[model samples]
Target: MASKPPDILLQGIDALRRVSRHMFRYRASIIAFFAVLLLIYGLYLRPPSDFPAGKTLSIPRGATLAEAARLLEEGHVVRSAHAIKIATYLFGGGTNIDAGDYRFPSPINALRIAYAITVGNFGRSFIRVTVPEGATVREIGALFALGTFTAFDYDAFLAAAKAREGFLFPDTYLFASAVTSDEVITTMQKNFLQKIGQLEPLIQSSGHSLADIVIMASLLEKEARSNETRRTIAGILWRRLEIDMPLQVDAVFGYIRGADTYSPSLEDLKIKSPYNTYLYPGLPPGPIGNPGLAAIEAAATPIASPYLYYLTDTHGIMHYSLTYEEHLKNKRKYLP
Candidate 1:
């Protein structure tokens, strides 16, 4: 084998030697070409010198990746739009960029920016807001308005949430500084569905429609504080509905007047509104406010009671009566 190398092998060795000599002759050019390529790559990865640190860049909802990159470049948050697009495509794993306000407290490279948008890293602090159990849509809007960081549109939220009064689940939510009215509405509605979904079987067997239950629960939420009292009130209210008697709940007046008073004036009670439970025979057109799980459960599983009337005294104690005269006596004793 070693006695004589094949002619082909000798030819290959000669070709390699020629190629090596050629490369050695032009090594400087090859090195310079690679060095230029690396320099360009490094520049692409670097943040712009005029980067808008401490500025917020808004990426509109439903915007494509290209649009987001353009916004970043235009806002001086990135060196180049093309570089960011390429970086996101290469590293984002085909995920859609999140839409919201992104604030940059400091300069960051293209790859970091791309990752931030792709993963929804808003780079802003979260505000913890608790929507109370009995809060109305307008009240919820006011609560969000108190947060200095939230850009929540109060009027927009009110308009959008008007029909979804009871469906907006009340809970503690940690919202980003840039949350929109639609986002808040969607989040609360989704949470309502999820929570209510768990009680679907109970609701189905209760012989009451979901709408009626929600409406009744809203009334119970304002009428009573304890779960036991809520269930008792629910029973009384349902009995009234069965007998074609007006609900006569005082809470709806507050909703009508956009006030927070449980006591309605005689003039206010005379107002002709569909929400007047004192005038209407059945449930009002819609829920007056949001209700918690306890109220909902009480409404869904009302306890059987023969009492036809009930009153909450000034001491917050509930009194139940079996006749109109007894109810009058309780009112006289409790009202003052």
Candidate 2:
């Protein structure tokens, strides 16, 4: 009592009391506002929790972002479905997310994952298959039957490629596991067209139809191993055609039987088939196998030679003779 309280002190006390009262009156609202801010920050910008790597996530075709989020949650790829949806909605390039099997080999952020899906990054892994040169359509179908691609149907592939026998180019190819038969056929055919385009001018001026060149090339593929040998054989075969002589190649027997044979007997040659070049004059009805670019080129530009007969021996050496007697002598020496 004694000393009167300072006016300044009284004023300071009044201000502090008023401020405390205001805080108490809206305490719940203030708490809620901070909570909402924290949630928003976590949903939009927080790094996702680390998960064990090597997980595969599959999103079906035409899946919405919400559905994808649920799938991710089920796979344990992401922690919260709601958070994924919200984050994707805000940062995803677009609403459309590409649907396919995706393998997460390492830890990745949610934002990056969303971006990858939106941009059609299905985490592409290729099944590499090698189709050897001169492979037949049936052989190629068998390869597809044993391929890693789960959706590759051997019967469907056979049906699709039956009519495309010599036109299906043989080469190593990489395709997704879910690739369709039609897609495989189309790709091989397109590759054939593109590769043949390089020899268009030569084919045009060679005075032989494209089909004829292909037929000759296919024979060379089976007959010879090197480009020079192919060219020489091409000349001998072409010379035979000019004189109305039969090609008499053993490779046609393999084609007719749908099996490979090193030596065809006289009885095998007696079988009546249009592909039997031994009986028929000139080229066969069609190609026997898919020939590579080198063979095709050799057929288009054969090196002229005086020799009329040729054969490969046990040591892989080619013998050429101009006379039938000489040919028979070399054959007896090398073959027997």
Candidate 3:
């Protein structure tokens, strides 16, 4: 009747119709399987829909895993408190989670979220912290506290720092927000040792001991405002000190006043701190600032020059002089 459809066309249509019927017969089972997958997804693999996500949550420094899990439940991040507790147990018992502030959406499940925080895989957003060239251990400790890392005790960290003096290399550090104070100090110490180890031969070649190199590097760090200036200043300092002249530095005065930068007061100059380079004939008892690689290298291999005097100019640039006359001229030109 339908123009007696072509024979081949008829056969194909009949086959397609049978397949469609069979598919419809299995549709309910397919839907049921999908439903189970959805449930599993919400519980273990992915987050539930229509839930507020990416809420800010901070885990205190000494907070336990149970506490973190409870906070998640309280924040409505996880629907079931009991389930989260059970999950924490199965996910390495919550002991593995690190201490830090975390941001997560409802788009992830408990296991995945816990793993993210513990293993530090949430995102790169690694915290960026810079320790300037000459920061002391106490100053370095304070920076950790400022970053919201609580496990660091200032007094304890100071003890550690003293034991590892001249070894806590100062440089920029990138770590997870949950990074501990001990970890940071340890890392710096290791770096310092490794770095100094590499420079040992150079130190020996300079006809100096390790302590001598450390002292020179410390002075170099205090004097350097730039890479080029560091080399220039190191030479002047070496030249003066070699001739029994005072290695006068203002950082010593700053140390006595518990300040890092300032114009010196008469009282500050008179303070009898061991770090008084102006008063003392040689390098201070220890370094005044944490030195970088460049300053350390400059201390080892200074620019050979005949200059004996150096001072900072009006533009903060350092000018060197070979004689008293030149030094006085530089001072008159630069000092207000």
Candidate 4:
């Protein structure tokens, strides 16, 4: 209006007005497109409607992210494998996912699943079970079976862990309610290796095979409750082995007959089993029970002592003697 604005300026204003009208006409369509994208993204984040509730999904060890995502999809745990992979890649900071059995009792989002696997946040309730030192494989199996949440298969555990008796480290473990026998065995054995790995130098320098040390420690574990007594007993046992003397440990009878008593009857000593240290002149064929770290260390580094005979009294007190006559006297004094 002021001097009839220049033609070029008028043309620019006309172009701007045309652009605004076009945007206003198509505003609803643009919003709908964005809403559709958001809906799709939200669906990708949710669990599949057919999710396998109360089912265990096993992720193999060392599985790649792609493989894990595929397994989650196949297990009906996620709506989209790609979404989980993206979520993990973004949030996990490129860490390896944990391998184990995962149970989803209810629906969970893909982001949650990603976080769980990345951080080993297994959603299942864990049952705390303590495997006592000196427990045999059978005893360990029974202990696990006693848990209300464990639904543990006693026979399967015994069968699988029979050969791994002493190698299965005894410790307090938190296991899933539906843990399998193989899983339990693997966990204990893995723990054993990890714990023993720390003492590798000591074990190597002791001039004794790991097997022998474990067997000796098993005996020490059953014979004495204190580290000092165990070390003393270990020295005595090693000296006896040098002279080819019978170990004559009564704990072997418990392994053979499944009896809890440490005092074997006169007849029980005569049993022909190779595990009978009284009948056999060397270390038992294998460890009678799992041993703790203190017992293991005592076996590896036995104290020098003159005592050859030792016994535990009814009150759990230990008596050490240099000769058989003194041992008998202590036995009479301490035994019931």
Candidate 5:
């Protein structure tokens, strides 16, 4: 007689068969679930790698992150297509990446690349340029060319900045290597507008035209070094204009000559240019150079004084005189 199978063994076999039947019935669903998991793993969790040497990718303007990812993968700059998009959407600050030409020289991670493009780290070199106060357009052009700040034509910059003199705020600026002259002007002009907007109330209430105030400020920039001196000279200059006296400021000669000299000879005064303050009364046609906020403020709000004439001596001390003879005496005594 064969030994009877244990009851426990039979129960276990029956349970196993039931489980197998259910699995067979849902085989397609099980396969689909695992396939989805594999797809997600490949697209997101995969590590990034460097493309073959010399490979480059071009992302067109207005392209979506998904499209950018596709192009990057096609160029072999990335290992996954949807990974970069997801990374940028999740981790990146969602800044609209600036549209421009980009260069990829070596391997960079997806997150890093995303951030770089998002913030416009174009993988090219950059330069920091500080346009000092009172820098003429010609001087600014030379700075850009000599410093290799960008591939800008000096003549072109001068032509563009000519109309924007005194409107371009002097400040330190960072620029990419491939910036154009027009782009530079736009940046500086925008900065000027933004900065001057802060003084809008004062500018409007000063009772002086914008052009006149700017002209006065330009003179103040070359006239004095300190805020106190700037205000004092501003008063004297405005008074001269009020009384129909020629400004007789030597700074105007520097503008005419395109030189930075502040001390003009008697012959310079004879130059027939309208910018010659000694020859023409009232403000010049336009600003001589970009002036700083302090000078602008001084020009807008000149301190009233009883004195009529002022001069900076050899020792840089300012001397004030109430009469023409006194002014002449001070000039001879201190200027010598």
Candidate 6:
């Protein structure tokens, strides 16, 4: 039998119908908003396949931003150029995106690419510049540039180096393209201070001034290519200095002639320059080369020995001689 519907049920039905009508009126707006969101998401989504999923990419020297973008897109790291720019912008503009080689896994997205460019690539583009033991400040600068820094007032560098001689640690250093010569110099000096600060007692106990240690270190540096050789060489140099004999280091002659290359000539030795130790009776006006830590240490605590002459053989091995006759024999055997 048909009975009258309850008032509450009828009211509920009416309310639902009114809400449905309102939703129909705004259907276009809802669809448009969702479509915009989809477009944005699709633009930035990384491609599924070639998305640099398994390999790191290299950004070689002189790479452009556009070229970098092309690489990322090919790797599927980014779906579109627009997406990469947007992601990079969010990652923080050109200032944030440091140019370097980057690695990306497959399915890497725009955000991942941006993050890699910003930070992950930092360690990838470094060059190692090794400053060998016994290199002078003048010598070190020359290694970086030839006549490029003719105006580079070495006065400041020399002033700093004179006080901190034999302290600049010899080691491998990593540097980015953005690094400057001044930065390198400061870094070496700082390393020197940290390293040599620990050897104050040794420098004092040797009854030698810091300059003396550096001078001895430079002399030792010229004579030794190994730790054992350095110790013995230090002894010989010390003995000659004590006896007031000519130090007669060929390196001093090379310095006088402004010669740093291999196999300096006989004529170079005869130059009447201030650095010629053969002509002058004492140490050179400056350190001959940058002295490494072992040479520096050997300079301070030399091995006690009675040998008067020592020479390196054809094999670059040293032969010690206690007398003139033995020295002549050594020269005849190895040098001849």
lDDT of 3 by residue, 11-40 (tens): 999999999999987997899999998887
The candidate maximizing TM-score is 1
Off by over 4 Å in 1: 1-68, 85-101, 106-111, 118-120
Query: Which parts of model 5 have CA positions greater than 4 angstroms off?
Result: 1-98, 101-120
Model 4 residue 54 distance off true place after TM-score fit, in angstroms: 2.4
Task: Put down candidate 1 lDDT per residue, 1-336, tens digits, no spaces.
Answer: 558989999999999999999988789789999998778666776888888776668899999998888888888787788889988988753549899889877998888999999888888877888999989999999988875644678889899999899999999998877778998999999999999988888889999999999999999999999998999899999999999999999999989989876578888778899999877679999999999888999999998899998987888888999999999999888897
Error of 1 at 305 (Å): 1.4
Which portions of model 2 miss their true places by more than 4 Å? 1-89, 95-117
- What is the C-alpha lDDT profile of model 2 across 224-330, one tens digit per residue? 99999999999999999999988889988888999855579989888789888877787887888888989999999999999999999999999999989999999
* lDDT by residue for model 6 (1-336), tens: 999999999999999999888888689789999988877776665464555444445665565566667766775667786667666767765534556445443365676667667664542334667888877666666555543332234555666555454555566787543444555677887887777777779989988787778787887787767877888887887788788886777767545555664444677666677667666666666667667777778888888888988988888988998998999998999995
Give each prediction's root-mean-square deviation over alpha carbons. Answer: 8.0, 6.3, 8.2, 5.9, 6.9, 10.3
* Whole-model Cα lDDT of every candidate shown, in order: 0.88, 0.83, 0.71, 0.88, 0.81, 0.69
Local accuracy of candidate 5 as per-residue lDDT tens digits, 1-336: 999999999999999999999888799788999999777756654445545433334578997677777877787766777677766767654636555656655766666667766787677666888999988888888888874644578889998889988888889999866667887899988998888887778889888987788889998999899998899899889899889998988888888988877568888889999999888998898999999888898898888898888888988999999999999999889876
Q: Let me know the TM-score candidate 1 reaches against the reference structure.
A: 0.79
Q: Model 2, poorest ten-residue lDDT window?
A: 44-53
Would you give me the overall lDDT of model 6? Answer: 0.69
Q: Is candidate 1 or candidate 4 better by TM-score?
A: 1
Candidate 4 vs candidate 5: which has greater TM-score? 4
Clashes of 1: 0
Ranking by TM-score: 1, 4, 2, 5, 3, 6
Q: Please report, as a residue range, the 10-residue window in candidate 1 with the lowest summed lDDT.
A: 144-153
lDDT of 4 by residue, 1-336 (tens): 558889999999999999989988789789999988789766887778898877788898989889999999888898888888998987753648999888888988888899999898877888888989989998888777875554478898898899997999999999888788888999999999999988788789888999999999999998898999899999999999999999989889889998655568999989999999887899999999999898999999898899999988888888899999999999889988
Worst 10 residues of 4 by lDDT: 143-152
Candidate 2 — which pairs collide?
Answer: none
